[model samples]
Target: MKLKPVRFIFFCCFPLSVLIFLSAVTKKKPVKEALNEPGDGILLIKNTNGPTLGYSNKSGIKILSIENLYFKDLNKNGKLDKYEDWRLPVDERAKDLSSKLSTQQIAGLMLYSAHQAIPVLTGPFGGGTYNGQPFSAGEALASDVTDQQKDFLLKDNLRHVLLTSVQSPEIAARWNNNMQALVEGQGFGIPANNSSDPRHSTNGGVEYTAGAGGKI
Candidate 1:
């Protein structure tokens, strides 16, 4: 099957170290860092739009600034690890991360997060029950996750998550932090690589045109 190259860019565009500010306030989680900006924890680059990626302050990741580029201290060992170092190739970094991951963590990472509905509804398609009860039956926030979601992250050790629908940008960010802290605090501190299915509006968006020289 042919893969859509532009599919990943939906994440890539957001991954850019562009958000200068990141919200770092959580009740149970440690408030390691704080920013006045509206978004979540993300390091800033002077005179640039923002960062290429973001780090969860609750995860204890520190920003390593070398020259002009900024990298994440994912392992939180005070020094920059190989996987977090931008100088290394992605394969090498993946290998480094994989080597440190436990068997269960690997299995969890291998397992794909199925279609998950936030604040699970009551119907059959997007609705689900939390702890064998409807979402409204319990005092759960819109971002409050389901029992099964927790099982996959904690028991299955799955790190690769697939987000289906979200209430809002703020709610989504909060959910990301909550989930990250839950998993990042355990095992080898491997960060969750969250991805999403592309969302497109056919009537509103502009059309794509191929290059004349067969180039990207």
Candidate 2:
């Protein structure tokens, strides 16, 4: 006779669903505002040093935590707030966006941000002339051109040749667009393509066309 022992059966239930709901509620925090008036009394984040792209303020500037910021719909997708919603490192963000944007869009954005002129072409001869000034190592970061290409331009003084022949036609078109913007003064300088000198009132005055197409 074989005797078999009965196995005990048990049902175990966990409150995992409740835990997850509670965790989300606990983690949610409010977005922060970028600027504050004295009456607002928002938490004052200590002034952190930043890149001096513009004229520096003698008095150090204060920052606020992200939690104190205003929430606005950015994408219009109904999502609340975004990393771009705050005033932070837009340059890095632009680079990030560039990775996702079309090449033309990236080029456009580069020109839009360039306060100084950006060269579309530099060559011994062309519609535009090469200044022959070597591209700075750091300046490459602010431009659409690559280090190798910039190096080639400096070595040969044939930047326009490269722009017309080497880079993809699509990119070249965008680069041209940026140049046009600079020439028109929409992207750089006041008077938008006119000379600052009161003596010359002509459009795209001497200064505007000085280095244009790489003239000496």
Candidate 3:
């Protein structure tokens, strides 16, 4: 068995200082362990343009594995394909991002995140100014989004959106605020869905695991 090298670009307002810390504390889980259970699970992932690899069609919707996103072809089909530069070319990859980012401010970050680019507004520990002060990474993202920010994100074209667990509220707030500012500058808006808030929950996306049957 061989391991494929994966190149990922992270975009955030602040420097990726905590990346090492986060990586050290969090072990990357395998795909099977994340989605092997019996139930309907939904998550946004990096989908390349090629044959559907390990994912299968559930009724009409597609259920994807977190591990399969590492390369163009996880199923070993000779043809390698992907939606490269998923973010730079805004029109090509805005729909999916829009689906997950409902609040306009949060959607802004999703657009930049979709392109693997981080905003320039994050702080020392992923803090976005909240309550007139810097908050933790999770706190920044969980704050009540502003309507002014929402109107700016939806104007652009997006493909898919990715949802993850809210480990730190301050980090989340900073990530969201940074995105909102960018989107506002770009003259777009995101339609926020109040019912499902990724900032408050973690059940939307699939988790990874490690093992022989893992999704690697």
Candidate topping lDDT: 1
TM-score for all models, in order of appearance: 0.55, 0.23, 0.21
Best by TM-score: 1
lDDT of 3 by residue, 132-163 (tens): 44333344334333222333334433313332
Instruction: State, as a TM-score between 0 and 1, how close model 3 is to the true structure.
Output: 0.21
Cα deviation of 176, candidate 2, in Å: 26
Predicted candidate 3, C-alpha RMSD: 23.9
Error of 3 at 106 (Å): 19
Error of 1 at 169 (Å): 5.7
Candidate 1 deviates by what RMSD?
Answer: 20.8
lDDT of 3 at 142: 43
Query: Per-residue lDDT for 8-120 in model 1, tens only?
Result: 76667675534422322222222233222335553333313333554455556556554434565666676777887767888998999888887877777778876665556
C-alpha displacement of 34 in model 2, angstroms?
8.9
lDDT of each: 0.60, 0.32, 0.33
lDDT of 3: 0.33
Error of 2 at 182 (Å): 20
Better of 1 and 3 by lDDT: 1
Q: What's the best-to-worst order under TM-score?
A: 1, 2, 3
